[model samples]
Target: MEVNPNEITNYATKFINILIDYSPKLISAILILFFGLYAIRLVNRVIRKIMLKRNLDPTLTKFLADFLLWALRVLLFVTFISKLGIETSSFVAILGAMGLAVGLSLQGSLSNFAGGMLIILFKPFKLGDTIEAQGVTGTVSEIQIFVTKILTANNQTVFVPNGALSNGNIMNYSMQGQRRADFSFAVSYDTDLKKAKEILLKILNDNPKVLKNPAPAVFVQSLTDSAVIFAVRPWANNTDFGEVSSETLENCKIAFDKEGIRIQPYLQELSKKNS
Candidate 1:
């Protein structure tokens, strides 16, 4: 068989011409890739510094920075592909379709993650703070990207999804530094209202846990057929609220007993006996 040198030379020439024609674009793409990476890093750093200046939560700042970094890198890759004379619209469309599929599959998780981001950014409550949300009242034990851990009064740990928690109402008892302990004490209608109010007020004043600045209040809230309801409101530090209320209720019972003030239930029993 006769070897054709002309055909071999023609193939080499075509290969060289193709490489020469694409070299500039390949080099430009490489340069853009490096520059785009640097720019992404710079943007991430700037964003982190801004978040720090605003005193945003450290966890949230890191999460956002990382997310932005990846997003920018994806955009940079697409640009690099386009610069190299590659069609990118179809690639971008494919990526979008994949993203949408993943998003749909993890809709609840994405919602929770978004909620957690909002919680961390807005800081409605912090760790160790007592909060009432999603029908659970407890101290926040931990906060994560999708859930919050709460330590209930019974020592049970409740994991609440951040989606429902952030979207729902939150009562941050620890935010104000103090909370009002409300108590409803019913007394017999025959009992002296003035004396009962004095006793309740005295109880609040004597308790060291109670805050004096707000000044505890006692008023006749409502009158029933058998009793007068006294609404006692005492302000105390969040930490001492439970103790303050419990001790005050115990003290009230003792004081009322000593003062010969018959409570509503006792009068009810007496009425039943007489009838």
Candidate 2:
């Protein structure tokens, strides 16, 4: 076998020429890639600061920033590839087709993501809000891209899909700042209606937690076979509602006992009728 030294030298010369011609583009592309990444980070920080200064929701602000960061990175990637003299139209078409395929395969997940975006943009409910939706009542703990985490009264954690939550009816108890506590008490037919109303109203007035603006009321809601049903409605701040109701009930029972306002038992009346 004869060694072809001139052929090997020609190959080496061609390689050097290709490297010399490609070096500028390669170096420039690398620089652009690094600068683009740094710029994306800077932009995200600026946008986040602006959003926070405007008092936007923290969850929403972070989501938007991340979305923007990825979008910019994708664009920079396209630019980097194009700088290398590689065709990008076909590449972008491939990306678009892949995205469409992914979107179709994840229809339900995409719906949830869209719902999350709507929830963030529309401000339906915020973190720590006590809301009732999808037959569940709990305080919102976390707002993610696909699901909302809730802490229920029974200490159970629930993850609710944003798609169903956004489309369904939501009752926000904490939004109004105050809530009305409804109580139904039964008294014997012979009991003094005026005196019962006075006692209930006095109980509400004495409680500092009860709101004074709406004014509490006690009225006969209905007449049952065994007793008269009195409706006691009181208004209080949402935070104080439970305590106010509990204390009011306790005080009312004591007052009723001291004043001889008889609360008849339903079974006792039925037993007497049978006897």
Candidate 3:
């Protein structure tokens, strides 16, 4: 190669001039980037405190905090790059394209994720709540980001996807603190409906688990082909609901036996057959 001292010197001088012009700017950008990151973290902590004090749903609070932090960091990075005189439009376009691709590839997963977010934010039910949803009735043992786990009374564990759970009808039995025990009792049509009502009332009144203020109700439900049906409804604390219901039925059978009251159809048919 032929030696070109003038050209080499000119290239070196241009390079030095460019570095001199950009050096201070690069330092400033670097300082701002570090400080901005620290500031973002401080702001995030303050946001967490505010959210906690406001009693914001914990899931929502965590997600919002994380999203905001990432967004702020992205903005800070863009600003730092722009300070170095680089265009940011291309970066934003690339980000949008990536997001679109990811969304397309994970449609079902995204749906479940969004559903979970809705449930957590809205709080239709919580752990320990006995809820009926998606064709099962159980106590909510756990609520995860994408699924819910329930323990059924029959000692079965069910895993329901959040997408279905959030969209499905949820019947929360434990939220009300009290539950109604509805019992149907039948006597032969020959038996007095009034006496049956009295016996049912006495059974309900004697049970300590049954509520008082709302009061128990005993009413003639229907006159079926085989018997006269009576409906007994009693209110009890949710914790005592099962016990109250079972004990009431057992006691009623005993009392009816002593009082010569028999349930409809069976005894009547037996007596006719004996004759």
Scored by TM-score, the top model is: 2
TM-score of decoy 2: 0.91
lDDT of 2 at 9: 98
Candidate 3 local lDDT, 1-275, one digit each (tens)? 89799999999999999999999999999998999999999999999999999988766777789889999999999999998888899988998999999999988878888888888888999888888899998899877777889999999999888898898888887887887777777888777677777888998999888899689888887777888877777888878877987887788788888888888643211100111
Q: lDDT of each structure? A: 0.87, 0.88, 0.83
RMSD of 1: 6.6
- Candidate 2: regions farther than 4 A off: 1-7, 265-275
Tens digit per residue, CA lDDT, model 1, 112-222: 999998898899999899998999999999988999999999999999999999999998889989888776788888888998899889989989989998888889878
Model 3 residue 138 CA deviation in Å? 2.2
lDDT accuracy of residue 231 in candidate 3: 71
Error of 2 at 193 (Å): 1.1
Question: Candidate 3, after superposition: displacement of residue 165 in Å?
Answer: 2.6
* Tens-digit lDDT track of model 2 for 115-181: 9999998978899898889988999999999999999999999999999999999888888788887
Count of clashes in candidate 1: 0
Better of 2 and 3 by lDDT: 2
TM-score of each: 0.74, 0.91, 0.75
